[model samples]
Target: MKTCFIVCPIGNEGSETRKNSDTVLKHIIQPVCQELHFQVIRVDQIYGTDRIDNTIYEHLKTADLIIADMSEYNPNAFYEIGYRHALGKPLIPIMKEGTDIPFDLASLRTITYATDNLDKASAAKERLAETINSFDFSIEQNEKENEPVHQNITPYLLKIQDEIEDLKGIMLKRNDEFAKQTVELAIEQIQKNTAAPENKFAEILMKEIANDPKKFKEFDAIFKNLS
Candidate 1:
């Protein structure tokens, strides 16, 4: 069966946004894939992380196409989608109504639907199914044959699989350290000022930083001092 990557958000049960998005995705997306004999691989279900992990990269390398929901402009979602675009993979970018499509992706084709209404979701699903059915794998093969060799990046792509694994290991350890320090700092701050809101704010900020390493480095000095 042909494989497709389905990128979307997954969070705790309390997260209404993720819940609603998953509901529509399972209801509309999976049925279409079944009919077309395509396998649907949801990144979250496979990797158990919101960000693109090594498993996700491996899946993308094999996927015939990617169906990405950019409804929330989620940072990780955008990152994964961008990676797919870089690989020249066929992509279907979809969003909920009223969400501003990012400027960088504005030139590409996309589908917008109203998640609040089932009718709109159904219409969008039908359109996407038709689009998927119309894909010609022969074109993909021909394009690959006609593509020029990129000597510079070809070596990097060859090593990317191993590099990504090493990076994930480093990131997991770094995030653990950050989380431990964050909790200690929050407790210390609370002890200094029993009624202060700073600790609560710090907790929120630290959680965000733990989720994204790029932001963590921005406050490297602070974290170093805390160490």
Candidate 2:
């Protein structure tokens, strides 16, 4: 799960750029990134809770790639791009149709597309995906290859990230299991006392859960407190 440090201006809901950004995210960025196995993180998603400067810098230093939106010639976006460049991180610079690329960065690779056209946005996504796939990571790999300290710790950090994703999936599965068990438990409790006729399907479900209570253990702690 490689990280993509997204540098863009987060505008209010009514702003045109915000609308455009949403289009870019849905039609361009998300689909392409999902294919490349990159987790997208932007300042809006994880910033301001900490010292703003430090939070952005930490992500810039660690993310595997940066996809910078230079759409507005935004000072903050450029500042982040400068910091990323200084760290020698890989980046893909993208901008709206009319935005200027800085003279100094004129020689660097960039993607420019129409924000007003969904068709063009889709085309640009394929181009951006191709550009990302073609990037040479040999420089970063070679440097890590020579460092014994980095070789050991880098793997540890990656494993921790992988485990975090796994735990998220496990937590979701348990939550779903608990909800199903609670529904069955409620059905059983009602059937135990109420004069109302049981729904045959629900009775079958309660019987199934009773026969396999171990699978319903996630609800035990919460259900135990009930009368």
Candidate 3:
């Protein structure tokens, strides 16, 4: 199933920031994403022992789509948005009306709504759904035109580029599966009543390694050697 990673400002519980974010999630983002069959993953909703930053990066790399809330000029939200942009992935940026978006993203398309106004929020949700719908249309268009053409060398290079992207996606999915299995096994061991303190430390170490691709690769190599 396709996933939509949400990059938004999640403040302390009961705070105004959290309340506003929750309102947007419940009233706007979640419903639209669900209708489109996109499994939404929010940072706060993620449980378990994984390092949050690493998990964010993993999702940023792999999620089929991204929805970013630009309210409050939140640095973390913008940072994640930037990271997704850097990856050259699709991201839908949304904001509350009157929120000052940073100069860099000022020119990008942003869906704005008034949190306190029902009509405006509903309209925003419609626009958001349309934007996401376009993604499916674009993918279909790409697929239709994916036939090899004998036109020029440029087409050949483009083919190579597409192949590279496909390979990268496959590698990312496999890595996620491997990481998930490793984490599950480690959790099972850690939950054992007789597990030692050293096992607890190992669990922490595993979480760190799982977060960093380079570290994870090194760990994988060592594990293979031991096996």
Candidate 4:
């Protein structure tokens, strides 16, 4: 099935932007996507401790289209949208009227609407759906035409690199200390666990560590000690 990734806020319901986005997703976006033969996947639904980032990354990589609500400039939403941009996927950027888009994305096309009016929101949804269905909306073509002259690293990759770099720094900082010995043990355990043939839990834990630098470092000593 053709899939579309929809990015919006999750836990915070007090924000007007979040409420309007929820309405658009439930009342308009979902139905229109269904009619257009597209499966709508929301970011908020994919939560938990195990493989969440990996799952979300896989979805973004494979989705036919992405609809990002930048009204609140949510961090996760921004990260997902940026990843889509790097993957050269078809993306529909929407925001509440009067909000200024970041300068970096100002050149890209975006749809803005006033959320207070139900009519405006509905019209915006219809227009967005129509835009997605149009034959001229080719993500591959757009990416090729606007391709950067130099190689640009994706935010996802950059994040992973940053985490690895942080780990390296932590190792250096702990060198010649008792903490170093502790970290060495944790790494040994992690390697064994990751090397195991059927340790899905261990794999999940590794991915979680890869995603969060602070958490990974705090427990790095303990994890390394494991066998």
Best by TM-score: 3
Rank list by TM-score: 3, 2, 1, 4
Whole-model lDDT values for every prediction:
0.65, 0.66, 0.70, 0.64
Cα lDDT tens digits for candidate 1, 25-64? 7777788878888888876567454555778887766687
Could you give the candidate ranking by lDDT, starting with the highest?
A: 3, 2, 1, 4
Candidate with the larger lDDT of 2 and 4: 2
What is the model-wide C-alpha lDDT for candidate 4? Answer: 0.64
Instruction: Give the per-residue lDDT digits (tens) of candidate 2, residues 1-227.
Output: 88887888879877987887777776788789989898988776774668888898888778878888888888988999887766555777888877887986664566777867878887688768866775554445322423421222222222233333434355455665644544545445444644222344346546666977765564455346332
TM-score quality measure for candidate 3: 0.59
Query: What TM value does model 4 have?
Result: 0.54
Q: What residue pairs clash in candidate 3, if any at all?
A: none
In terms of lDDT, model 2 sits at: 0.66
lDDT of 4 by residue, 1-227 (tens): 67888876665777765577777788767877898888898766767676778888877777777888888778988898888878666677777778888887764556666657878777777767756764333434333445622222232222233334445467566553433443444455444644432243345457656776565676665447542
Q: Weakest 10 consecutive residues, lDDT, candidate 1?
A: 149-158
In model 2, how large is the Cα lDDT of residue 13? Answer: 78
Off by over 4 Å in 2: 137-227
